[model samples]
Target: MALLINHCPVRWHAIYHSHWTALQYDQQSITYQQLDQLLSALQRQLLTQINLTTPPSMVRLACIASNGIELLLMQLLCVRVGWLFCPLNPRFTATELSQRLAVLNTPYCWIENEQDADSLPTSSPQLQIDFELLLSNLHEQASSSIAVTTNISTSAITLTPLLIEPEQACNIIFTSGSSGFPKAIVHNYRNHFFSALGSQRLIPLASQDHNLLSLPLFHIGGYATVLRTVIAGACIHLTTYPLTVALLQQHRITHLSLVSTQLIRLLADPLFNAKQSAIKHVLLGGSAFSEEHLTALAARGFHYHLSYGSTEMASQIATSDNSSQLQVLPYREIKTHRGEIYITGETRFIGYFRDNAIHKIAAEEWVASGDLGTLKQHKLSIIGRKDRQFISGGENIQPEEIERVCLQYGRVKQAYICPTKDQQYGQRIALFVLFSDSTQFDLDCQQLKHYLGQKLISFKQPDHYLAWPLKLANNQALKVPKQVFLDSLSKQGLT
Candidate 1:
């Protein structure tokens, strides 16, 4: 591992020597020098394509793509130029894309290619930049660019001063929006810098470690991985989707991040024997984790970290090594008021993007994270989302509590409990269970009722039970929208 400064005014990538590997994709590997040249070329091509109405600080360089080298380079280019790099979910529908683009106000967007054009509106402007040609042209000029960069002293070279300032807006990532329209969360260079720094302290990464780009680039976890890898001078592997055990073994990945669902699927993989793998640390986030899965990982001698974070806080606010409670990482502060978590820190986002500009969040203001929790002895334990709590039969019900109990059931793989209208009780609990075995579809409701009868009190028990809607879960989004299940139940006159 090389000695590298974590935070500075200049581009973080420039901190590492030219020979260090920055990115890896199957047979190809790119060094810091090569990536720098690619980023410069991307910046030149992007400027010629965009038509901005605001200053560079306000300009949003919108892109729709999956986790890949191009998207990673685009974000680095945005940081270099002070543009707000907004990455939209490529799986978004035409309508979903249009709604978000209306808020973005950028004249044009960069799409993957012609095939992706249909997802955008007919009137929406788009630029299909030829990355292959851009890379080829760079190869022709690689010698000169490499020589020019290497000849200059590190202190003499710097990204645009005003544009790359720590306070300048750097990225706009949308919330998962599991039930409704997503909010555009804004983050500055400082937010990401400290986030990467804090994360490295908890989950140490070195130049020799290979960090898997497991999550989508549109996600905060994914984007944070890019910065963490660069700041630590580590290598990032851009692996293929439906990530298999074979792929993990082939890459010899040391560090990775995953949602609970992805972790469960990987554990279920026949080829996965956690004890034999090279994986050193796994950062688990997104949803409530299953104890059964954790126990399985423990039985297999796998190492994992449970983290709690949001889009508003860059990525990780707190993470746990082996304990149930999360330990607050460096550069972030957390407190509980009336059982709801409030956070104010360097990693706290700039604000929510709206009306073509960020509605800035003052540095002194402590943002209320809608999550309810308890802070004791400097450790945080999450209860559940305040918004997810509902009143049924005049008794308050926290869906996560019931969902956790359902997950404990051996046959249940994923459990989601949502509230639906009930004439007798105003609102009633509805359980959607994704079973581990397909044969569970024939499960008798009475048997589940008996099981719940033992685990839950009468009031917390679910009124209706249904098998998980497979079609609704078959999306690119990390978590399935809970509203989708409620709607399906509504169609069946169960609401």
Candidate 2:
């Protein structure tokens, strides 16, 4: 018999046995039984509060919360009921949330706190379910005399069996919307399950292991990790605070997933040494990583797994194990058409949600990833964005390629490649760099120009250099708006 989404076969094992530790938060450990019970209670409340007699034809639940047991439980409840779960980033402003919410036409929304509820537009009729109140209610019911009664009409609330077909939409994750408003990408159970399973095959996971949950539950990277751990019956350590070197040590975290910027910070910390035996695997992606960064990780004895993935792909397209340098996994395949990477395999997403503007693939399909790469020696190396490429004096240059090289410098914290007008070159390449400390780092424009000249061809070198401080989004620190940097440079008359 095929596995279904509503009734995950794993749940049977989870219900009977309590050995699996589902979550650790605030120094309190929650077992699988506790998690299961919590989910059941939440589901009951949802049914009663929403008057859900039957699951919607197109199930969609909008969840807005940070990383915690509550967020995990909400997702699990949705999966158990075959509901389409949409996890929205808590950091998004009300206007941003409204735009995304409008696309889904979600009937119910779960939010972190009352502040989020207040921020929501009054005109929007969508019900805002307070997470704290819901939790309090669940706790009260669990502790009350009503807990002894098993007479609640479970029959009215039908527990839909999980019959996940290959094509059914499981969830819709929106992009970061840095360039424009975020697009909702629809992924099925197969897409998420395959990503987790494929990753496990490459980097072996055991029931004894524990994974640190620092990534936002809204993003695919963070969301996929939760699914992977639950399927593996492993423990997830949830941290409300930011991921720092001290936190990793405090938790004795074995596995972690980080973006390039996070890894750079970890590497800079004096206490960060790969020789420490506790950490097992550090998966890095989300942006281009410098060759120097890879080499440094290797030198420190830290096991690094480089991945190429996006919201549309569900998480990882191609992953390499650090044990053998950086080689693509055996089961994965990669090919480039017109410099764009096209991935076809079990781990691909079903399609984008609601919007039919984008073309769809036929049955047994593949995704045309907008990002570019080249496959060499059974390994894939990312070049740059095909759309971001600009022309300079009849010569074409990829800014990401140049930025990758610039990031190799130890003092440079982050870099962006933008195009500026030049009378001689037509359109000259410009570099915006963020340094660790301006006082200590004395490298000037001339020195940077010479450095690039030695490493790159004359046409590829950035003609303009601007030193700027890094500023992150108010909600999510990981995302930096490229337009903001460009505007700043233009204001200073540097562009």
Candidate 3:
């Protein structure tokens, strides 16, 4: 029983720090106290616009848009009023959106515009609300030039902005998994509370510091930033524009959240010097990364905090502050069972947002991380996903192991490997790779196969080779959809 650093009770929404800057989205900004007022305004607007005469105990709101001031407002409103805010990726197709909405049982879906509304199933159960109109009205009414939100009525409803405990559910985020099903992970106030606590203990952020939110809000990476900055009393730059060297310097961003791919791109840019960039911290979270790049950044005085966390864990279970080794943070315990990582802690996610309620977890209470890793001296190094393992002929094959070897080659930029059916071996390995942009390094199938052949055993080596596109989702961190990958293979006649 030790006191946690910066540990404090959960404040559903803090109305006190009104003058201090809380958010920096493009040219606009909002203070912590102003944020509280805006949420209240938006709550009144939700009350007037939506049908909630006999609202159920659990009310769910779905948002289809990129990150913005309005989306942040919706998120905070739900958090304060005990509503579940679900953000759907605008990249999802009509069928994808329809299927997910049905599962969510959502009565409200706030879309970016008319075009986004048209993209969703017109006949779906969820009522689509024009968020832009709401924002316009709010701006016209509010005196502060925080862009359109003052018009939002402050009329109190029966259910007020109640103080929610740490354990109460705050948000439900849908994450793409290997199971090929829409798994909505439920996170409570505590999950975020301690996650922020762990990160600050590792690398603290001050109120004057700014963290650039480059990840999508729908993903846990993006959601975690919101909670982290809020808890630290630090300002957040919520811009939709892609992170660039000029942009980072222009915004005077001290902290940033990025995946591995983004790191590589920054490394490639001659203007992005680790020592000169002035970025104090980079919260590295994602699937793939290289030690050479990490070492280079470290040598140049950059602090890349490698973290291993997921939607179920609310974010970072382990993080490396100054060193490359990821040390497990306090408020959580990390143990391995048969080489698989399992997390049990106050910050772990409550459960999957399932239908009805059998409120059961798999096996023991500890959440199975489904990741293979080595824990030594309380530090964890994630090797690969256990579910990513496949059998080739008779021997077990880990595609990530092969991909890791391929990444060592100077020309290889990105990689993806999966099992393709084979009668002789039961299953065979196939690879789709992207080589570094270079005229001299003209990588071909045979050349890559030859490079990997020396590094990997024949069984673990890929039997087939396909092209990897330069642009992938938000980075290599987010895996491509199963069907999308299959269709790409089919189109290339590689399947």
Highest-lDDT candidate: 1
lDDT of 3 by residue, 1-495 (tens): 222222321122233333457788787666555566566667777776566763432677888887888787777666666677889888778888887787777667777765667667655444444556655643454455533222222221222334454555778888775666768888777778888888887778887889898888889888888878877777889876777888898888889987767888788777787656768898887766666677767777777788888788887889988676889998878899999998888777777776732143542478778899999998888878898888878899887788878877766777778788887888898887777654534356668788888988788888877666435634434555456566777776656
After superposition, candidate 1 runs with Cα above 4 Å error: 1-16, 50-54, 122-124, 137-163, 442-447, 472-476
TM-score versus the correct structure, for each prediction: 0.90, 0.86, 0.86
lDDT of each residue in 297-380, candidate 2, tens digit only: 888888888887778767776777874234555435567897788777766666666642223455466667677888777678
Clash numbers, per candidate: 0, 4, 7
Please tell me which predicted candidate would have the highest TM-score against the true structure. Answer: 1
Per-residue lDDT over 1-495 for candidate 1, one digit per residue giving the tens place of the 0 to 100 score: 333332332234444455667788776777765676677777778778665555888777788888787888888778777788899888778888888888887776888766878756757677657789766754555457666455434422653222346788888898988636899999988898889888887799987899998888898988888888877778999966567788888888889888766777788786676666788888888777778887777667767788999888899999998555699899899999998999989999989899877899789899998898888776888888898999998998988889888877766777888888888999998888777676747564566678989989999999888878877543435566777787789887887
Q: Among all windows of ten consecutive residues in candidate 3, which has the lowest summed lDDT?
A: 150-159
Pitting candidate 1 against candidate 3, the one with the higher lDDT is 1
After TM-score superposition, the amount by which residue 427's alpha carbon in candidate 1 deviates from its true location, in angstroms, is 1.6
The clash number for model 2 is 4
Q: What is the C-alpha lDDT of each candidate?
A: 0.78, 0.69, 0.72
Clashing pairs in 2: 4-162, 5-162, 6-162, 7-162
Which residue runs does candidate 2 get wrong by more than 4 Å?
1-10, 51-57, 125-167, 274-277, 323-333, 355-361, 440-444, 473-479
